[model samples]
Target: GDDVRVAAFGPNYANEKFTPRCTAVSMGSSNNVQRELCRAKVLLVPTKAEGGPLVAAYAWALGVPVMMHNTGIAASCQECYARLTGDAAADAATALSIVRGADTDPRWQRP
Candidate 1:
């Protein structure tokens, strides 16, 4: 857990508190977004309501694994998506497991 770094991009409408390891990333240019994505080991999109996240596409293109809420394009995709029950604790646990898996799973590894 200490080895993992979490970065939050975009607005935090919920005003959720983050751990010290989590950094709040300001929304910036597309290049800045891409630079962040490039450094990520996995991209986790936990939003329950979304049509299709453009960032997920960018992550895919960069060969980064994605663990997203089961909605929109993530619903159609066969791998790397989870059904969120709207329970914050449960959802966070699920997200953690997904991230851990992505770190070790060969399927999530770039070629």
Candidate 2:
């Protein structure tokens, strides 16, 4: 959580300049960006409204765990996703625990 940070990849977000402290976002090639996601330890999707993004599936295919709250995804997505609530620190802690684990396999197993 503290060590690794989140970045967005989409549209003109690649050119948009955000505050230095803000996470890096690339709105460029989806394929390239997705390929890069493979090395990442966590993928956070904290959107307010989403119609189950395909990226979730892609993450699963690559074996990269996910940390989500608010965003929705297709039924087949097996990425480790959590419903964030209560406190922000709690969510961060949850993500930290997952990231710290050595196993690359996702924790979220939907029934």
Candidate 3:
């Protein structure tokens, strides 16, 4: 199997037990949130709720693809990404499958 590491930064991660493959860190201050997010190869947004287009737009602007639930907002972004069903488990599974072969979408390409 390919090596995979999971790291989460947030209060939700505190006191959570994870497999050896996963790690959690504090979310820290808001100032550095973007910087921290950029470190990731892909941004995972697992919420069923929609936070408007900017949420996914910002990630794409940072050159990070987002795997998020299909809440209309993500699809509206007009970017290529794996759109997830509302089911948490299913979404996560689909995201993993997509990311394995994911690449920067051509829409994000610059001349």
Best by TM-score: 1
Model 3: per-residue lDDT, tens digit, 2-101?
Answer: 4555666445655536545466455555557677657665677766776664656667777666777666577565455566567767866765665554
| Cα-based lDDT at residue 17, candidate 2 | 63
Instruction: Provide the lDDT at 64 for model 1.
Output: 80
Number of the candidate with higher lDDT, 1 or 2: 1
Looking at model 2, the pairs that clash are 9-26, 10-26, 10-27, 11-27, 52-73
lDDT of 2 at 94: 76
The TM-score ranking, best first, is 1, 2, 3
Where is model 3 poorest over a 10-residue stretch in terms of lDDT?
102-111
TM-score of 3: 0.63
Q: How badly does each model clash, as a count of residue pairs?
A: 0, 5, 0
Model 2 compared with the native: what TM-score?
Answer: 0.64
Per-residue lDDT for 1-111 in model 1, tens only?
526667776566326466444665665555487778888877778787899888988887777877677888887886744566778888677667767677576556654
lDDT of 2 by residue, 1-111 (tens): 166766665554455365565665555555576657766777766665677767766776676666665556633443346555547789888778777773743363221
